[model samples]
Target: MKEERELQDVLVQLSSLAPGPADAPKPAGQALAVIKRQVKQEKRAGCQPWQRFWQNPNRRWATAVLSLLILFTVAFSFPAVRAAASDFLGLFRVQKFAAISVSSEQLALLERVAEEGVSPGELTIVNAPGALIPVNSLAAAARETGLEQVLSPAALGEPDEIDVVEGGDGRLIIDAAGARRIIELAGADPTLFPEKLDGKRVEVVIFSGVQQSWDDGTVLLQTTMPLVEYPGNLDPVPLGEAMLQMLGMNRNEAARLARTIDWTSTLLLPIPRNVATFNEITINGSSGLALASLDGQYGAVMWQQNDVLYLLTGSGDTVELQRIANSVR
Candidate 1:
């Protein structure tokens, strides 16, 4: 009886998937073809399993298996349909847990700097754990796309050594040993860093300051460009509707939810409140953000120029930071 009830419930869900009568848009060519095929297959009668499993008269078990198989096939094949499903089901979502697009430890550093707020002349060890990547040499890294070759602050004169690193589509990471080596060479203590950076592969350029102590004297610059163009209203609405139709979703509901999403013009970056002062400033005649540590002794100034984001961070005066930022050509 329990099993029968479960099977009935599934049937009910499946039945409810059909789109209702409405002014809903029609599916695209490919999607319409698939949907029509699915309907035709459902109407056919035979237990040819591979050829037409849904037509099997075997009842509950075969029906359930075939239905699941169809759902998986459609979901995997169509992205619009997948998006509609995710939106309707609310199964997965992206969440923001911290700021700076770096590690939790790097978030802590930003927050601490924000709290200190401008203690001039105090050379503090402003750590950017995840943001830093080690490279064999900048010359080697210059060969890759989406990376900068020339970047250095005139305020710091000459760096002891420079490093370059890249990240892939997913957040790239380095082991603790590599992180330690990076920090150590950059004149920072390896012990002060976390085990991993789990950060995206934006281009990072590190300029080690003339400090024997790793606690102070480091300048880091990071740049990132969008990997993929913003997905505008290009998703075929009918395809989404068709997908929902497969799941027994009503046409009206599917049509309304399957429409393409228009993301906002500006991407939001959530920086921790305690990290520094958030001030909007003009960079090369464009809007930008300048973050100065609580002590005002260290800071990061950032701006998006030509779709590429530029971040200059160090324990230096804001004037110098801006100058370095302006110098990035």
Candidate 2:
């Protein structure tokens, strides 16, 4: 009887305070204390009447809603919680998403490379016109190696001109225009690329091409279109060379083992499997991979030849692209 009387007293006070505006001043401390004490007593003693009321699903749901309301009230009352909530809600903000949103697997691959301390290979930083070494001016030594191999495909037409950039000892600097061209070659947004590429250096090989006229051997159907090529595996080092150099093996034995070793699979690009579509292509009888965009456009093409990896990307038709691929001599 005493507990019932106390509960009734607490309910009367709550009812009096509940009739005000939602944002009205909070209830008196004494009233809140009485309600808290009554609820604690009922919960600890498992009051038979209160337990029966909660047994009904509707009443249980109402209790849950009331609890949530109280929690939200307390949460908003704190400045920190309000700020966190505002920030948390900002993820739904409207904006353009960019292609720089790389997959987790790609990030993991980069981490693995960093951890393994693998060299990222040669880097090129394109400078102004005066700093660039014209392709025709390339030393015979550089041309003999993978550095000067002409990746310009025949279908794209003859390149107007080419440059051999030593990149100031392998560190290449690319300007904003070059960066924009690279992003387009990747079929990515220009915004996703580095904002300040003027003199910003990177480790990737960049063969930048600009077409002046279609008759001048520009591969792209559109004239004056910016075309960029990032070729990999242009030079293949024989494992036999390593054995002969490292283990001091005889030339004949190393040559025999190197001939037996297969180097075709070495030029692999680790594309993610969850992409929209992946199709197998044959480039000169060698297997290649083609990834298509969600709207059925050819997003990218990768193939290996002479132990070199060639990746071509743009907003081009697939059939025309295959013809262009054949021209990459």
Candidate 3:
């Protein structure tokens, strides 16, 4: 009930804060079409706002953080699937996976913020980083992505289709003032925001990758280590704690969790306890995270090996998922 009350209050605040029309840059035509079509489908389905929130195929923590960024920039500006963090050098790669528990109420509140507080036109896509281009063969995919070692599941045999995703650099100039205001409105501690973080820019580099799909609804994704460059003066710990608090976590809990994570090299995966089961598993010799739907119908295994992050998802149990992952070569 507390979260619901907060959601209503946030909705009221958002309505008042909605910006007037402006000439914000938009996504390219093809991307725009896809967005519009998806919106239409959602409207037709009459799905609840929270249900629609979970509908995203790429609902990782990185996506959640990007949504938060969009929410903060709704009046001024404006995202990825893979979760990654930077090293001391400011270049990010996913070296480990951490599972963070999120309650259903928290997810609902976050969805309400996104659906009621932000609109598409409010976000200006400054750079369209990359596109998924179909490739005729594995060798072609390797050539396009410049990946010396392209992996496939030996258990699954040949994939029906392969696509090479182009990667590029994109920058986001933070509107810290706006973000602070939003955090305050959400009943979080505004003082947690760092003053020096204002006007700072975060640069994101998407590394080229490959996606292979089979007719049976299996997907295998491999990408080079992606990078996120935070300003040298910025300490991501407080920023992360603030974001977590805004998501309804208590200050002490949020701080503890934030400090435990190495924001630069760990991918935080938010797991809804009511919907899925998560476990830390060993895949071959590498540590991995295994996730399965509560119903046991679908599962995924994500691991980083040899500087390449790999994700395998399919309609299989965790054991089967692990078997397929181990067969990757």
Work out candidate 3's RMSD over C-alphas: 17.3
The Cα local distance difference test for each model comes to 0.39, 0.36, 0.65
lDDT of 2 by residue, 10-93 (tens): 999888767457656566997899879988888898766435335544333322322221221111212322111111111111
Candidate 3, pairs of clashing residues: 85-264, 86-264
Alpha-carbon RMSD, each predicted model: 30.4, 28.8, 17.3
Clashes of 2: 10
Error of 3 at 184 (Å): 2.8
- Any runs in candidate 2 off by more than 4 Å, and if so which? 1-151, 165-264, 273-276, 295-298
The candidate scoring highest on lDDT is: 3
Between the candidate structures 2 and 3, which one is better when assessed by lDDT? 3
Which ten residues in a row are the worst by lDDT in model 3? Answer: 79-88
Candidate 3 Cα outliers beyond 4 Å, as residue runs: 1-91, 115-130
The TM-score, computed over Cα atoms with residue i paired to residue i, of candidate 3 is: 0.70
lDDT per residue for candidate 3 within 85-106, as digits (tens), equals 1111233566887776668887
